[model samples]
Target: MLRIFYHTKYEFVRWWRVAAGLTLAFLAAGLISFAVTGGVNYSIEFTGGTLMQLQFKTPPDVAEVRSALDAAGIQGAEIQQFGANTDYTVRARDEKQVEAQDAGAEGISKQIASALDAKFGAGAVTVVRTEAVGPKVGAELRTGAAMAMLIASFFTLIYLAIRFDWRFGLAAVLSTTHDILITLAFIKIFHIEVSLTVVAAILTLVGYSANDTIIIFDRVRENLKKPHKGETLSHILDRSINETLPRSIMTHATTFSATLALLLLAGEVIRPFAWVMAFGVVMATFSSIYVAGPLLLWIEGRWPRLDDAATARAVRAGEAAAAAPRGADRVSAR
Candidate 1:
């Protein structure tokens, strides 16, 4: 092997520098966005509202249906079509409060039906589906989601520590947090609706972030058993990184490709989620190889031994020490 690794030290070094600079910039932007936007503007799940998904026998008239709801005294109600099909999702404050007449999905659906009936006739329209999630349920969901994310971060940190080292785990967790911040920053900048679906996407991205970090850490651990024990720490890490880089690139590339396809093909309802994943995979890839892996060397004090030979040398030296002490006692006994 013509030393495939460490062949482009300058390139990797510059890459690391740029990555660090970009990370700092990202954090700054997140802070600014947080200050400007006041953090994630959570959807009904956090703000207290009713989510009613509806399906009609025929594609309903958006303007007429909205007008009917407005006439019924509903406020801040949103109606949008979903999928390539003729389904619609309606979200609003408590239907009772909005309409002020003990309005539930039952009542709202009837009004929507009546409105559509006027447009398309009674037999021509049907309320095929209806769901009602109260504001109280939405609040509980928001609390549950936050708790789930915190718990997930905790468990992920623990897993990284147990599997590799505490430092690696901490960095991995931090990197995941970074990914979340960037995702939220995008939401803020774009003014995207931070709905329950978005929360679900955030949690899923957390795991995706951890998975990438774990892969590189696992490689570092394996390299620890090799014989190149006396190599420089940066060079050793560079080699380990190079060895795993292909797999990381391939995995993220495939995911990115799929997410891009979804972003292009899927409805706007799903685009935000797909966009988050697409962006997250790229960040996760870099953090795993650069932040999480390189962090071990920097934090624990690097030596040039992130390879199998380096590990073998250490093991051999330990064994020799153990045997030598015993041999000296035997000689004295003689």
Candidate 2:
């Protein structure tokens, strides 16, 4: 078997300031973008609209299709080529159109179909699929997605607290929360459409980040059990991270490869999900090392455990005893 990053001693915590600064900068930029754009783009599933997939006998001009929709009173509809040049997905989620949908579920879809039929002749185009969501249903789904994320985080905190202690649990939970915020910022900056599938990706990312933190923290706990007379908590953290480096590398590499493949090969419908997962792989690794480790150190400093303080006192006494012998030897030689 190949051994990599084996028995290494790297100071990961020393760069915590740098990592914190970079994270804050990225988040700031995301906030600016969000303000400029007025928020993230939500798909019809969340916004309540008429979605229609159309297939044409021949490829139709996109501009002409938009013109037809506008002529038929379906303003501000989004038209994009889905898979093939001859296939297109139309979304009409404007406030007026959503209100129109309240009158009848398929009303907007019917108008879109008629407009296209008039533009390309009666039999030239076909409606492959149509989905109509009401405002109430969309609102419910949006709320449910939010609740799901909150519940997942709540359970994670409970589990971590039981598994370790409040310090470990709080650090891990905060790190996981950081991952979510960063992922959301990425989505906003890049304008990825918010949908049910994307929500699933964010939830998966939270678990992945939390698990990574748990692994390193568990290692730290194990190391603390053994005697290291002069080692500080920061030193133990660095050692724990170095010990897990090889495993982290392999796991993240494989996951990123899979996500990259999906990003490149998956169709348009899944691209947003793939994008989130791809960014998430790197984000999880980063938070595990930079975010969680430092947070643990800070928490320990703020409220030092009794056992840890006792151990620190013992270390200092040992160092003083060793130095006294050296001082006597030097005085005698002089």
Candidate 3:
């Protein structure tokens, strides 16, 4: 394959400066979002509630379902149309039950199906997905999610340390967390309903951001082994980033375009997921260059010895050859 890695090192250096500025700007925006909006707003699923999905033979009227719930005094109920044209999803908390049993439980779903069947016929609707979240279960889920994220971040730090230098790993972990926090900030700002899907989306973005970091790390390692291994870490990283930058941009551009399409056409339900992924991809690119590279410089560049070992080796070797008398003398000298 054609190796363009050495060709575009300087370009990535310039690009990194621009991307870093944009990243800082986005980080500020995300921070403001966090300040204004409380942490992510959990959905009924995560907050303790009932979810009933009914697939009908025809396109069902959404207003009728909400009206039905309203007539029964089901306050703050959320009804949505799911995948396909026939599915209807209804969710509500079991906070204040007027009935003896939890009305938002299985019995309520059965009643809903029966009511719809009375008008649309018995075989018109099928209950495809249903779940009942007790208050305790929701609390447990929330706790488990928090713990998982903590553990994942810790393990990521350890893995990054073992894979490359501790500086790269530490920076990668920080950048990953930054991506997650910013994504959550956006979610909170827009009041995205946080469900299991949102959790999955966050985890997915972590993996994605990590993948991008690892790729750059790999390129850096490869360049460190080449003849220019004596190059400055910043220059080496810039080179690696430039080599991979094209591919990274292409991949993210394709995904971003697809996400934009989704954001435009997809319903409210898919909007949160699409936005999170799109935001993460853009942020990950910037961090892979500036955040990660600057970290290496800050940590390793603090000392005079470690800072120039690679460059010194290459420069000395070149000067020795250039000053040698002749081809035969250089060969004989070696």
Candidate 4:
């Protein structure tokens, strides 16, 4: 018989500086983008806009539709095929167009209908749907989304605190936030419009990143209970992550594969959503291992008392459990 063994001693915490520097760079770029762009470019859903879904008897050319809208003097109008060649969605903010300042939501709808009717004939075009959001209503929805995310983070912290400890929850939350910041930075860099769909993606990443962090933290807790000889906190964290590395890699790989497929084949309608999700999964995975674990270890190093008490308790519990089996064996022998 032959015995084989592998030694694992990679200290992820040691590279904390590299991770921190990269995060700082990302944030700085996002801030600079904000300064340059005036803010995140919000979609019509965030800024008040008139949205019209149209269906024509004949398949309509997107360029012609855009040209029709442009000729109508509807500046900043965005036109795209919704699901089929004959179906299209158009959105535009209120702007001076041919002295129609009094064209309210209904008037805007009529103007769009008139423009398309001229191109495709009176009875050939159908107004499938129309949605108009006022600036106040859009602002409220945006604010509500921000509040929902904040409340979610608060509850996540409480849940983690009860499950593990305050330090674990704190670290996990911070890592999730980092993932969001990086994702947002990328969104800004690419000039991707921040719509409700994008906000949903950010929230999805928050939950996902937290789950990954919890898995790693749960493993760390178990490892702490069974102290390895000559293992420092950093070593234990490294070991915990190493043990979960296989699972982490497999989980993220499968998600990435799916998301990448969606990005390539899901069509323009969903490309932005898929792209954000794809970017988010990668960031969440990296933050769980590199950012969350290192931050926890750094906290322990700065305030030893915080972890020392928990460590001592775990050691005592482990020793008592070990003695229990011995005591039972002696009794049975007697």
Candidate 5:
């Protein structure tokens, strides 16, 4: 078996300042993005626009499709080839532009489909599907997405508390929240549209972040029982993290590589989701070690009682002693 090497005595907890700095930086960028974009630049799914899927008998040239749409005065349209080179998905013009077009979103979709068919030739292009969401439906979806994220976070906190110590739970929750904020911040910076898929990715990231934290916390608990006489809590935490470093690296690297592949090759329809997932995998890994571990240590500093893994071991030792005496006394009396 190959052994993974790490500095068991290294003081990772002492570098909390580095984690704090990165958090502040992400928050600042997110705030700037908020001001610049006038809140999130939500995708058609949340802002109400037309989505059209078209298929061609032969591969269609993207530049030709763009030219046709431009000639038809459809500005700000987003288009990408999906699945096969011959199949393409086109988003209608931006919400403001689509709303200004007479009639409704369906009218806009028909116009775009007509333009593509004209460019390719009669019957060369087929409209596989067209979807139009209204403003009211989008608003409801936005509200529901927000509520879903909150509910997930709430349940994660509850589960961690029950499974480990309350301090570990609190630290895990905070670290998970940090991952969400950082991912959202990058979404703003990159102009990745906020959609239902992205929301799902964020929810998945919450669980991923929590699971990683729990792993490290569990190891910390196990190590506490056999601490060397002179070892400090900081040393124990560093040791625990080092011991689990190999497993964490393998899990995180595998997920990160898969998400990266999606971001690069999955096309624009899935790009927002992929970008968020890829960004999230990196952030979750960092928080699992830097943010979650340091927070646990910080809590340990403020309230030592919350970090009492040794208490259980001490109780077990006392019970064994009591039982041994009873057995020995009975033997002597007999």
Candidate 6:
């Protein structure tokens, strides 16, 4: 098996300041974009609308399709060509059509299909799929998605607190929060449509980032138990990260490959999820080393663990005492 970064002593936490500045700048840019662009581009699932996938026997003019929908009073519908020239997706999520969906699930979709059929001929167009969401249901779904993320974060904090010290828990939680913010920024800057699948990707990112932090922290905990008399916490953190560098590299590389495949090959329906996941892999690795490590050091400085030194000394004394008896026994036997 190939080995890389074996026994390396590289100091990863030394660049935390650079990482912090970049993170802040990116987030600020995302905020400015949000203010300028009027917030996230929510999908029909969370914004209430009718979505129709239509297939035609021959290619149709987008302007003609728009004219037909307008002629039938299905105004403000968004039309985009899908995979092939003969396939298209129609989104009618205007307030009027959203209100009309409350009357019947198929009301807006039927109107769209009828309008297209009338313009192109009855048998030329095929309604492949239709999704209708009512305004009230969309609002509920949006609320539910938000709540799901909040609840996941809350439980993750609780779990980390139970598994590690309060300082480590707080640092890990904050790191996970940073990952989410960065991801949202990426989505906003690129205008990735917010959908349930994208929400799932964010949730997955939270777990992935937290897990990486936990791995490094767990190593730090193990190292702390050993005799390292004069090492500062930052040095210990650096050692821990260096020790785990190979594993981190392998894990991230494999996961990123899979996500990249999805980003390139997955259909449009899942493309947003893939985009988020692909970006998340890199962000998670960065936060694990830069964000979580530096936050932990700062936290330790703010609330110094007074017992840690005493505990280390005691461990060293105990080991020395244990060694004395063994050495004496060997001497006596010789």
Best of the candidates, TM-score: 6
Pick by TM-score: 2 or 5, better one:
2
lDDT at residue 175 of model 6 (Cα atoms) = 97
Candidates ranked by lDDT: 6, 2, 5, 4, 3, 1
Q: Report each candidate's C-alpha RMSD, comma-separated, in the order given.
A: 9.6, 7.0, 8.7, 9.0, 9.7, 8.3
Please say which candidate is ahead in TM-score: 3 or 4: 4
Q: Roughly what TM-score does model 2 have, to 2 decimal places? A: 0.88
- Taken over the whole model, the C-alpha lDDT of each candidate is 0.63, 0.85, 0.66, 0.75, 0.76, 0.86
Across residues 285-321, which tens digit of lDDT does each residue of candidate 1 receive? 7677656644554443322222355554543455312
Candidate 1 whole-model C-alpha lDDT, 0 to 1: 0.63
Candidates in descending TM-score order: 6, 2, 4, 5, 1, 3
Residue 327 of model 4: what lDDT?
Answer: 11
Candidate 2 wrongly placed segments (more than 4 Å): 57-59, 83-86, 307-334
- lDDT per residue (tens digit) for residues 82-124 in model 2: 8899999999988888877778998999999999999999999
Candidate 2 clashing pairs? none
Residue range with the least summed lDDT across 10 consecutive positions in model 2:
325-334
**TM-score per candidate, chains pooled:** 0.71, 0.88, 0.70, 0.77, 0.76, 0.89
Candidate 4 runs further than 4 Å off: 1-9, 52-89, 95-106, 119-130, 306-334
Q: Write the per-residue lDDT of candidate 6 for residues 1-334, one digit (tens) a residue.
A: 4375888989777788889999999999899999999889998999999999999999999999999999999888989888889999999988989998889989888888888888999989999899999999999999999999999999999999999989889999999999999999999999999999999999999899999999999998888778777676777888999999989999999999999999889877789999999999999999999999888776655445544565444434543124211111000000
Question: Clash pairs of candidate 5?
Answer: none
Instruction: Return model 3's CA RMSD, one decimal.
Output: 8.7
Candidate 6 CA-lDDT value: 0.86
How many steric clashes does model 4 contain? 0
lDDT (Cα, tens digit) per residue for candidate 5, span 31-87:
998897777768776877787888899997789899999888788788877678888
Worst 10 residues of 6 by lDDT: 325-334
